[model samples]
Target chain A: MPDPALPRRVRVHEVGPRDGLQNEAAVLPVEIKAEFIHRLAGAGLDTVEATSFVHPRWVPQLADAERLYPMVADLVDRGVRLPVLVPNARGLDRALGLGVREIAVFAAVTESFARANLNRTVAESLALFEPVVARARAEGLRVRGYLSMCFGDFEEGPVDPARVVGVCRRLEDMGCSELSLGDTIGTATPGHVARLLTDLHAAGIGPDRLAVHFHDTYGQALANTLTALRHGVTTVDASAGGLGGCPYARSATGNLATEDLLWMLDGLGIETGVDLRRLAATSDWMAEHLGRPGPSRALRALTHRDTPTPQDKEP
Target chain B: MPDPALPRRVRVHEVGPRDGLQNEAAVLPVEIKAEFIHRLAGAGLDTVEATSFVHPRWVPQLADAERLYPMVADLVDRGVRLPVLVPNARGLDRALGLGVREIAVFAAVTESFARANLNRTVAESLALFEPVVARARAEGLRVRGYLSMCFGDFEEGPVDPARVVGVCRRLEDMGCSELSLGDTIGTATPGHVARLLTDLHAAGIGPDRLAVHFHDTYGQALANTLTALRHGVTTVDASAGGLGGCPYARSATGNLATEDLLWMLDGLGIETGVDLRRLAATSDWMAEHLGRPGPSRALRALTHRDTPTPQDKEP
Candidate 1:
């Protein structure tokens, strides 16, 4: 039981601007994207995955990353650590040239997902990421590894927990500071997660070294996160308005909604340092700008059909 | 960890027609409600909570429970276990008159919610239920306990986990065959559930003595359920199209979406005796009928777009 006296806090990593926007057909303007991140930062999120450094042909949604990076230079100028996704050494070089201080590298756990998503075999993908992590570490930049399809895959029957552990071990050895397991296809259950994390923990993986990335595709991400937490995993990846999807995974929803996650944390006596009401407003604004429905249920239920009071309209 | 050989099977107790409808605004016609229950049963849900026996003034949606019971003779004739909600002695008396074989009784974990929702204190609610359970047992009827706000409540924040354990123990002592802990306001985080269940376990509450009832209000129900599973919880309460909400708590979302739960369970190598494609179709039908969007992301995504066929749709 939590000591009723001790203050509880949780860190929420915002992946909307990168993981969220990457899969949307609507290409937001670089300024809008920058403003989006700016708005998210103002909401009290500590770390936000800002953009990806992949070639335009690979992910055109972030082709404006170069322009967007300079637009948000004010954040870096203020010492906020905004990380960018780097696909390979070339992507890493591009990010470095842009004066990025932190980078994220990802590889799929299952061979099918890796081939479908990254156009490479599992081993080949990890091999490609090895030097990128080393280069980033050598340059004094923090490195985070994403292991996608950690639970289930579309084409693959079932992702082996052992394979995920193996991938995580490799990433850690390559100097990846944190390992974020991704349920790319959104096919995870709490039971699968509990069993897998038990194995992951027994395999010498510590909670501090792990983060969880879940899609709401199966509505089990939050539950899976809790299962991971039972074994000591803390850091979680969420998207504002619950935005983002896997490009290769059809019918997949966005990452676990950030507003929803914050609500739970807030109620649990776990402080997320997020102004949930403000986060709801941010989600609403983005939904309006994107011409799509704001996906967060908490945001919709809290803000819609209700007039804002003076305190709500202040910012 | 799981012997890597045994199959994981989850038993889903669909409460949409009974627990769900009892909390909705729409007063669905008896025929429509019957159709809804029939559809859920057709989707491979072996246990469907059918209706509730409560005063019309209290729950207008389930006011016609007595009338709806006879309409489901087709289900009873087919040997489907259709359980109905009974609020108190009077409700139980009415259910018995209808020849109901199974009934569910509910009490809140927090006194505030009990008083607000049921106009009684937790003790008063349980006291009122003593005769109901006693009589049900005399009638050879199966009884289940619905522990509302087991995680948290709107008026009473952070319910004492011990209080929850105490109420559950009392209900079990009263012959409740299955005890369901509800996240009535959906304010539970994975960490919170981990702590709560851990406390319950320490208090000698076994997983077999518990069922998990979660809401997606904060989108952590699945995660919270996963936390329960980590502690060995098997039975879960879900609503079709995520149909259900708290009349007292205006913005609280419905119970965990049944189709979404089934999808994750299917993926986890868990046998739920539920069909994913049929569940998705049922949700689609119900969503259209209700003129509202289905809250199950898995069902929505599955029906909304084309999906690449999984190698094995069933384990």
Candidate 2:
């Protein structure tokens, strides 16, 4: 029998190639980015976020999306799924022209964050994305809606759960296939996450159509994920080597590390089909090119697993 | 009213001074170690692991335990708990000579780890600790037993849970006031942690007499801590700035950071009585002295909470 304590299989949506590198300080070459995506797929990640179609002025790092998509577009036949981020109707059109099958849109639960991040009010931003989501859905693209600051906004200590529920309903009503509830500040504890998910479930957004995107800002991401999982949420968004940047908590690490997520899943006998060693090696390769350490604890341990006998410090 | 989901108050056993520094590659001066301990206690960590009584040759980093103890001994009046590690009869004698009221003994759960870490068989190591635990209790000292590799051993993937239970019973029987079950390799997940705690409860070692010492090697420490808390565990071990080295996972980060733990406890409405900002400041100070970054994500966030708008990297 499957373990009742955990989901039988978790769908780990790998956001490294796009989400990870987008927040990084150094702008890696487009070749490295494509190779990173290929390595992630080779590591058995079923879904890898390829790139975002935001204007280059907004995110110059991911500006090569036009050239980057074709390099790995053939992977669809190999049973790998690539989801690209489309910020607006123009972006969605670009993705559609590239024949993208899945796309994601983002929104903040708080007006302050919404204004700061999107230069529009929450209502205005939602109105702006309504057509984008409709057009993307009409184009047969599976859309994932990222509800950032759902747990707590960076400007406000917490956005009301009812408000988050409202946003989730709006996004779902706009034809999004899934909603990734993000604790944008990573200040959420298990109790907070559990309460939010419980409220969302009561609001008719059950685990089946929901995912959790948590930052490690306060180091609560994994714990929050476990809480969400206990509430039957199976989809989790993680970045390889824990890439990504949090404009809210800039000094903080970004998304929960995929390797860290897989470690818990592996120990619980939950299947994700992601080869951890290969993922760690890919992350290690990326870290070398990034010229700094990745925030992933598991990646570091696994990468250094074969080091010589350790005796200089106490275990 | 306290949240039913978490304990009302958690006794954070700060292990940074001893466990954290001992694993670090760069050894700070004894005065810095002493100051760090003072700062931890100043930050309101009631239980601080001051130092170890092991021989200098074995743990040269803590060689000044004798001198260090006297510097912070005054904290006893301030309602702080300082427990010093004693490896054997000689170590206990050294601790006793200094009028130490709290002392700890360590024994590995696996023969392989026992040999590699202590250069003794599991049975032999326990045999050697028999006199030490006895004499410490006889001297009116509260003894803590560290059951290393209780969850999983580095050499042997995992030891039998029954074997861990037997060791726990023996340590309790030998007058160890508390048994700190350790995931020495930091590989334990929530499921594994829950299962072991269940078995330990079945074996008559309830949460009342148990604590958990987990490394963040795989980024599972806090999640494991949350699971332990949900299972009624109230005492959690953490090092400030997530210091310490895993002689096992040398590249792995140290114990769960106190700031990270407090962040959860604070959010869950659990009382820790520790100031998060001061703890973060102390960790930041220590990090600067160490000439490397601290691994505590919360400390990093709090340390950089006031930095100018972050557009340099992704979160």
Candidate 3:
């Protein structure tokens, strides 16, 4: 049983539709991506990150978001929140044109990753996102700010907890509804997460105003998520099929698989309202479309054990 | 800086040499396995699990343990503890014949997994290992008992924490030096872990007598490990390059990646004597040999960042 005083079910933001597929080599059909988003929404995810409005040259895989977003407009009619990633003023402009209600901006904690991955320095990237946030607020759009490499970075090594707190404060002050701290390189341990969260909490960042995005790069994402939940964080980010990886980092897998996340949450008696079996099917669907084995270890295990025969390898 | 009460370092039992390669499809050469063990020892791990004495049919990967064990014996002379896995009486007999000093035995908490994976029910498996423990004690060999599926299982679903405690107590009664609780399917969350540890502690299972074995299946292994560590459980089981996976459940990746574990411990100022660089190199070596990428997300990130040019492929 859950403590009545504590939040029983955290809000999980499904990022596979956007962040998960955007990094893949395979360019999924717009219909397939739309179906995945619809299925994820049907599975009861609080927020489905639909697509990124970045330049095609940067992330070619998601170049079809223009058509993809409108295809899932029925979700919006049903009152489901669909947030899209807006990298800059241009991305925000495009997302706004698509009638996006919620927008997300991402920056890194370290300058190296900011420059390498996002093509901007920490200060420069945050500066670029400020006006976008302002425009979104004026347009009655909800804005979310994400600070990547909050725990550690691939290029610069261990991240200072204070640096994360500083970034969070900035994002919060910038009119972002929620600030997400990401262990971008998947280098965090529970102790590191606890220490960082505690420090941030002491710095006056309330858990309700915070979210955590963990990669299964090192298989510590869910453990890190649990640590955040204990601290009263209500929002988490997960990818379906665990389908995203850092293009800059080798051997990095993807984010915490949503089905696996739902599995653990279900077992804990927490109410996420997500269907594990349905999510597993969606993962299998994407795995087949991608022409690669799905990155989710948990979904594969469930399918293998539950399926009477192993012949259904196709989507 | 570390807490004054914190030990500068913790012992990392590198189970990859034994636990990892045991489930691998391609059998490594005996010299390669020996070199792998030697490198782990040189990397400052206080204990490196070297080999198992299970029948070759049970685990063909480590069939050359006869030649591999004696080859790495000098590490013990240098104060490294080499622990071997013994399935039952016959396995123990063979290990004792090799002059084994330390051994480990495991039982599953779920009846279905116990019967399917271990060829016995929970009670019967426990009974089968009791005589082996007695013989190990008589022969002056240290014994450690592992309780698998401590969190939950694929077939049996959620397992009772009380049952885990009962098994731990039974193993202690059989003269086992330590009891390791394994979240075999990686379904445990931190709350689940804390509650289980608290219940076990209240049941008189002291921290000193407890060890933790975690799989990164659901990306919660390290967080669960930290929960156990905070409860004063010291010894941890990890695999190099995060090499192992459940043969029964392929998507359940192996134990927590050693690099990810060490990186967190390093950041927290907890001394885990394992050299992060050497450990990373060892993972890279193994990955190269296997024609697969290393299992660790953190190691891969660090290795990629350090390389002169970015890696074109996943490996």
Candidate 4:
């Protein structure tokens, strides 16, 4: 039975192709990236973040976004929402030219990260995204605003929820339909997650328009996600096979593994249209391509067994 | 800030030496095992499960329990709780001979695991533990009952919560002071955890007498632990550096990592009296001794950094 405090159904926003790969050291061929997105959609993920339209110099791992977009266009026609990340107007134009119906804009909630990442202050970055968001909305595209470092920053320490709320309000006012709150450092606990959601609700930003993107850097992602679900936020962002690593923190672990999230969701009897076995196989296959084991416990447990005999039972 | 619904402090039952090593392929020397316990205690783990008195043939990894206990007996003098596992009257005798103050008896909630593990029916295993618990308590030793396969069984599938409550009641009535609920196969979710705790509470088994031993096989350990904490469970079982793996499941991951759990508890401002960096370093040290990397995200993130330059920030 589902917990009465949680939503009966959750939409898992698959970000493996884009967010997962962008942080990886290896750059895959465009065809492989397109196939990965298709496989994710085939496994019942309705929305898959395809790739980022950022400049090649910034993210060479996803440089083939234009080519990759066309390869998975059939899935887009079949009603899978393949949203790509757009940093600014130039990236927005690139996504629009590919007939993209949905796009996400990234923003830093900390001034340290904004200056380090975007070469601008937090206010300057938001101002830059304003016109890009407005133009995306004008073109009838759904815009998702990703607010990173919403929980903690390495340089500045714990971020204030009020500061995060201000940025969220600005993004919402700029016509962004959804906000994906990123715990980039993966340092947020359940109490902090509850407090943030409570503050957001008090500021008129309800759970209906919120998605939680938690990293497992400190192994708090799933627990934090559970707290968010209890607060009525249903959409969760997870990478396939726990693919992404934080470049800033130099941490091997990254986003919460989708398989791990599904294990909990499936056990709770909550509806998440994705098939666990098929998804684990996809991740295991991807791990082989990457020449390393996937970081997901569930994926490894499901796919790599040690030939258990009856006598091997724990005593 | 701590969540108002959760406990203010938690007792971390360090199970690295006993439950962890029992499943590991590499059996450390008695000296190393004793030193590991000392390191764990030095890192602020007040309760460290030393080793099991199970037969050498059945568990060769912990065969040197006799030699190990005396080496760490000074910790008991220092007011640290060092519990050992005793399988039966014979095991209890061995523990009592060493002047052990606390011992744990293992039981299974499902018939399949009871037969496979203890080579007896569930009732027969409980019947065997009856004398063990009675004798230990008669000798003024604190007896803990470890009920495994509480959430799932590979052969039988999802075990009923009512069945688990029945075993728990039996254990409590047989002079056991505490019961450690083990999700040996790691298939439980938050709702299942909440439901099982509620059922146990209704059955008059309160959280004070209950501890949770969750495995991270499916990566739901911490989330389920959070639910348990919200339900007022104060004691949590974890392995340092995620030292153990389930022999039955043939999975690499095992008990919830002490470092990972510490990260969450510390972030939530709940007191566990553990030094995160010290505990993580101990795990890393143990991993080197065992010739494998520890399966802890927080430990890896803290110790295995890629050397972050200022320009390596995530965008």
Candidate 5:
């Protein structure tokens, strides 16, 4: 009998071009960011979050979103998923006008992260996103609701799991096709993950409606991913080269690296449909461009050609 | 009720002083090496591999083993376990003469690694160690037998599990206190570990008589460790600051970092009695001396002072 906790296949949401670059210190040219997105899609990622439509004045790093949207429109037309973050109805309108077929709305479980990140409280942010989710879905665009700080906030030691479940359930009820639970601080362990998922399940949300987004801050990203996979979570969000960071936690690292996640997925015999070698090479290029090796160990090893191919295939 | 696959507590074998340092390119001063061992023992690691007795002609990095022994001799008398690597009868004599109560022997499951590393065929290497093992035990020393390339070899991929089981059983029958299965190339995955441990269990060997060693070459070490823990294996081998290298795969990173393993163990609430923060500090110091940051993400984040202490406990 198949294990109840493990899934047969997983969907990888590539967030390198958007979430990764947003948290990076050095901003890349529009052309380079465009190329990075294409490279990730070419690496066989089905879903690639292209960019956020938050006001350019607020996020100058993604100022080229208007120009960037046209560059990857071909992939969008080809049915390759390109999700853009929409903070409110205004952002949703901007995305829909660009012929975008998928939009993601962001909210935080804690008032502190919400106020600091979005300049609104949790209730205020969710209320703002309600119309955005409705408008995006009404326009025939699939909407994904992001629940950041689901595990814990930086200032808050541990956010109550009941509050997390309430926030997630509200998102689902508000027409979010999926809710990506964010471990913003990377402090959540396997036990925390298991417990949170169990509580969520008890709160009438199943793994089928959930995706896990974890940061590698404390080095538990992959282990947490493994636990999530065992609990039937088939969708994972990762950044190429582990790009991005938490504003509150200065020393905290980036999102789980795509290559690191792929290593474990490939090892578990679970299909991700993403080409490991190509994704690793792309991260390597981005790391070199950044002037430092990013946090992904697989990228470091693969780029160095340290991995041993089978003798039958070796020269 | 507790889960059947997981263990309550685990024993972490700190090989940073011996295995970790030997693979490093920069040879540290003998005093630094001695102090590193003491620091590891001070961090609550009861078993710290102090050094190796291999010919100085072969491992000039550890050429100061003779001088190193006397430095930490106080820990040995204080009931802190210090196991040193003894590669041969001559090496065993050197360790025994130092009044070492514990020693380790090396063997390879595959002939290529055995031949390339020890200059002997697998059978010949095992034959050569029979007397050494006998002599070590005769002197009342606890001997650990390491079977490397158990998962696969550099030149030959996928060593037979039966062969590994046979080698381990022979070592056990020869009176070795424990057998550590080494994934020398670090190509091992959770499934590989599960299958190997399953076969080993069928051979009548449980976790008590076995320890698992892994290299983080592909970034699957911690995930693999979780799998091993589920199978009731309680002993894990780790290196501080993620020091060391594979003789076969140079670009392949070192053994699993102790901090990385500690993150999972602490998360799982599995007791190891080792202080995570203290160990991370020592690795930080060692990494600074090495002129590079070590691979442990926990060390990177902790040393960055990013972790939040609980408010009720914060000073």
Candidate 6:
């Protein structure tokens, strides 16, 4: 049975094609990236972040975003929500030209992360995103504001929830329909998650307008996500096969695997509309293309047994 | 800050030497196992489970239990609790001969697991453990009962919490002072954990006398553990560096890494008495001895950045 404290259903925001592939060292072909997004949607993911429209110099791995967008246009026409990331007005224009209906703007919650990741201070990055978000909203596009480093920063010890609330309020005021709170360093704990959600609620930013994007760097992603769900946040951001890693955190792991999240949701009797087997197969196929096993324990457990020979000798 | 609903402090039951190494393919020398235990104790693990006294043929990796226990007996002298696993009366006799202060007996919550793991029916295994637990307690040794497959079984489907409560009552009635609920297959989720604990509590088994042993096969270990902690379970079972895997399950991963558990507990502001860096360094050292990277994400994130070169290309 589902926990009474949790939502009855959750929307999994699939970010494998965009957030996931962006950090990958191997630049997958545009066709492969398009196919991956298609497979994820086929596996019952309603919303798939297709790719980022960031400059090629900044993210060479996703340089083919312009080409990739048109390839998966059929899925978007079929009612699959393909939300692409737009860094600024230039990226927004690129996304708009492709007839994109949804887009996300990335912002850093801390000055250190803002300077390191965006090459701008917190205020400067938000200032840059304001016009992009306004323009996207004006075009009848759903804008999602991604607030990175909401939980903690590597350079700064512990993040203040008040600081996160302030940024969230600014993003909400800027007309972003949803806010995906990012634990970029993945150093968040359950209590920390609870405190942040509580603070956000106090700031009039309820769970209905918020989503959680967690990294598994310290193995706290799923636990933190659970805490968020208990607080009535229904949307969770996960990468297929645990694909993405944080570039700033020196030894960061990938985002929480969709398979792992599905296992927990399925066990809880919560509805996710995801087929675990099909999703694991997609991740397994992707793992082969990457020439390395995905870091997701669920993906490994579900698919590894089918392989004739075990990869690791430990188990 | 610690969650008000969770426990203030947790007792970590270190199971690397016994449960972890027993599943490893490599058989380390007795001295290395003893030194591993010493280092774990030195890293602030007060209750380290020593080697198992099961038959050498069944668990050859931990076959050096006899030689190993005496080498780390100094830890016992230093007020550290070093409990070893004893399968039956014969195993109990071996532990008793070595002046072991505490020993744990293994049982299964499901009939399928009982037959598969112990090669005996549920009743037969309990019948066998009766005398062992009685004898150990009669000798003034603290006896712990390990009930495996408390969540789901590989052959059987979802296990009834009432059925688990029955086995737990039997174990407690058999003179066992504590019961460690083992999700051997790692298929459990947070709600299931809360339900099992609630059912056990209804059967008069409180969290103080219960410990949780979760595997990371499905990556739900830490999340399920957080639920257990919220339910007031104070003792958690974890292995250093995630050293073990299930021999029965086709692709089961290792136990919840002690380093990962430490990361969560430390982040929650719950006192565990463990130094995270020291514990991770110890796991990293053991990974070298095992010739594989440890499965602990916290261990990897904390120590991997220190190495000059990156190991995996994904991140």
lDDT of 4 at A25: 80
lDDT of 3 by residue, A182-212 (tens): 8777767666777777888899988888889
Better of 1 and 5 by lDDT: 5
**Could you give me the TM-score of model 3 versus the true structure?**
0.88
Weakest ten-residue segment in model 4 chain B by summed lDDT: B306-315
lDDT string for model 4 (B1-315, tens) is 446888889999999998888888778888888889999999999999999998898899999988999999999999899999999888988999999999999999999888888889999999988888888888999999999988877777777899999999999999999999998888778888888999899999999999999988888899999999999999999999988956655453589999889888887878899888888878988898899888887787778656221111111
> Which parts of model 6 are misplaced by more than 4 Å?
A306-315, B306-315
Measured with C-alpha atoms, the lDDT of residue A199 in candidate 3 is 88
lDDT of 2 by residue, B67-110 (tens): 88988899987878899999987888788888789998988898
Q: List model 5 lDDT by residue over B171-248, tens digit each.
A: 998889999999887777776787788889998988789999988877778878888888888999999877885655
Q: Model 2, A110: alpha-carbon shift in Å?
A: 0.8
At residue B80, candidate 4 shows an lDDT of 98
Q: Deviation in angstroms for B85 in model 4?
A: 0.5
Instruction: Give candidate 5 misplaced runs (Cα > 4 Å).
Output: A1-5, A310-315, B1-4, B306-315
> Mind giving the per-residue lDDT tens digits that candidate 2 earns over A1-315?
234967889999999888778877678898999899999999999999899999987787899999999998988779899999999989988999998899999988889888888989999999999999998888888999999877665556666788999999999999998999887777778877877888888988899999999988878889889988899999999999999855444454589999899888887778899888888899999999999879888887777756421211111
Off by over 4 Å in 2: A1-3, A247-249, A305-315, B1-5, B25-27, B305-315
Candidate 1 lDDT, tens digit per residue, B36-81? 8888788788788998888777888888888888888578778688
CA-RMSD of model 5 = 2.8
TM-score of every candidate:
0.84, 0.94, 0.88, 0.96, 0.95, 0.96
Q: Let me know the DockQ for model 1.
A: 0.29
lDDT of 1 at B22: 70
Q: What is the descending lDDT order?
A: 4, 6, 2, 5, 3, 1
Residue A177 lDDT, candidate 2, scale 0-100: 88
Segments of candidate 3 deviating more than 4 angstroms:
A1-6, A113-125, A161-163, A246-253, A305-315, B1-9, B117-121, B245-253, B302-315
